[model samples]
Target: MTTQENVRRVLDWAVAEIGVPGIVAEVKDGDQTWFASAGVADIRTGAARRPGEYLHTGSSGKAFTAAVLLSLEAEGRLSLEDTVNTRLPGVLGTNGYDGDKITIRHLLSNTGGLFPTGLAPEVSHRYATRSGILEHRFDTFTTEELLRIAVSQPPVGAPGDRFEYANGGFHLAGAIIEKITGNTYAEEVDRRVIQPLGLTHTRVRPLDDTGYPAPHPRAYSTLFLKDGADPSTVTPENWESLMEEPGQPPLDVTEFNTSLAWSAGNVVSTTGDMIHFVDSMVTGSLLPPAQHRQLWTTVSTEGSYWMPHARYGLGMFEFDKQATGGRTLRGVGGSLWGTWFLAVGTPDDQHTIAVHTNTEWKSWDLMFKLIEAEFGVAIGA
Candidate 1:
């Protein structure tokens, strides 16, 4: 197939393999741009997905959170070395963890060693307010209550020992932002990044599925009524109605209510906005030169036995450099409520690609492969 045809086929395969209602992808290199969409936004209604439709970026939101925090540091409002207790007192104490011992750097780099609370479900239920979601609750507990839950749980490892990838660390980062800025985390994010970048389509508010914006794809999930049922028997379907299903609860699928993952991962955005933000960061426009260097420095590796070539930066991932066919792509991947997003690119060239889908399938890998072949460069793994 021709290069253009190869790109089209990769996108087509992604939509088909994931069983997504639709996908909107954007790619840019130098002065060139390419946009493509496949499948329906709402299969039942035959609606098509559009380029500007916002999707839940899941953990991919971490990059934005990290950027905001770095920007705050650059402004001399705070320091990465500041201990958590120095900013928010008596919060981490309930969890038996010393906030004073955990620095902002530790949180940003996922080296804090906090355990993941099974609180995503609980946070999803109690918090409807944007602030409330950033301050996720456990059994209706406030931010303080959730911190207590985290403290009560044993540490995954010693602070700053190694990377454990805890969402709680980011949540703490969000709380720190709130404590320092005296504003909602959403407000800080918007003022610092969203507004500055003019990302009109991106938002930190809860998604409204019923009255979803035009040309947006409906999310989907795989559900099984019986335990241990054949996984293959399950099928993907439009999850737009799932948000409103009575006796079914929306939090069941995503429990990111607390901003515990706030600085780690809680922002919602569009593919275009993500690519734009990434472009700005790599180009040293959003962050100071020194801090931006710290952001790209590898702090950990993400893959385990099942996936081998994934590495972790502050909040981003470094997939197989060789597999990407040699383009030094740096970005993040997030999954929430069966929705998935991947934003990636290189620094030297202006090349960047973002893929968003409603179903949480492995089809996103194809996006990197297509870009690799298109650019003919190896992204650092």
Candidate 2:
């Protein structure tokens, strides 16, 4: 069988065994590109997943935010060592923590130890449940509000000491970008990365965009609230109901506001655009020497999520070769309301695989299998 056929076989198996409604996967190996999709993008219309549909990639956008910051550093607008106090004084660490202790480097590396922010767990859990996202799909929030929710809590670890994924750090990074350039994160990303890269379909969701742009698939998930429970009656004690029901039909969650994540997880793009971004990023062609070093210098994440011994450098992740049979892959991966994505390639940008699914609820091993199929290296040995 052809290599493309074999890849399709793997995707089909994943759809059947993993039980996601639909998926779009693209692979770039040298000059050859293979694209495949299965199931339906919109169950209501039975629309097949397309190759060009956009998806809301969650934390994966962190890499893009980091790249934009590196670009700013290349321009001498800021330094990685600049502390939170330097950029936005009196705005961080209101919960008995010190903003002076955190640096831009620490935030990019996710070692800032800024509290995870109340919205982090709350949104994560809410999205995980079937209809939880529907509760406030149209609600809008400011970046300042999200940051306040985060700093309202104490630090998770000392600055630069340990790895703790804090979305607030990226939000603060966005704030710092605004402070330095006098532009919003969305505006900066457009000027630096999106427009220059010719990513026409890619965009940073504006604070008021409660719905996704057209030519996209509809996303679905289980309700976060209990069966027949009123959305208005939700309470912290029953918030655990946000867990997805294994055998229930998914509710449509395609339309929802993304400002809750702001610079941290609010970028939307297609599989092809993501692969292009990853290629430019890993090859060191995206930034200058000093800023490039900041992009690659990594610290251990100690097996966060599905990646074993993963190291985060800036906004990207470096999956260790030792854990993957001596073949290292670098990029980022995460899920959102109606999307789950993983993009990783060799450091030289010669080979790459990018996949997007319309559903976030699935077995973690499903992603690992997709990686192994595309890159010929199994994760976790």
Highest TM-score scorer: 2
Clashes found in each candidate (C-alpha, N, C closer than 3 A): 16, 8
lDDT of 1 at 103: 85
Clashes of 1: 16
* Residue-level lDDT for 312 in candidate 2: 84
Candidate 1 structure quality by residue, lDDT tens digits, 188-228: 88998899899887766442222234445666554212222
> Per-residue alpha-carbon lDDT of model 2 for 1-381, expressed as tens digits?
655676677778767887788887898998998899888888888989888777888888998789888898888888899998999998874777678889999988889877555335445445434445656677677876877766866777789888877788898898888889988889999999898788888888888886766678888665355565544344334554644356777777777887887888788888899988888888876677788778989899873333455888998899866778887689888776667888888976469888877877466577677677777677886
Question: Where does candidate 2 clash, by residue pair?
Answer: 117-150, 129-222, 130-222, 130-223, 131-222, 131-223, 131-224, 132-224
Q: Candidate 1 at residue 283, lDDT?
A: 65
Clashes in candidate 2: how many?
8
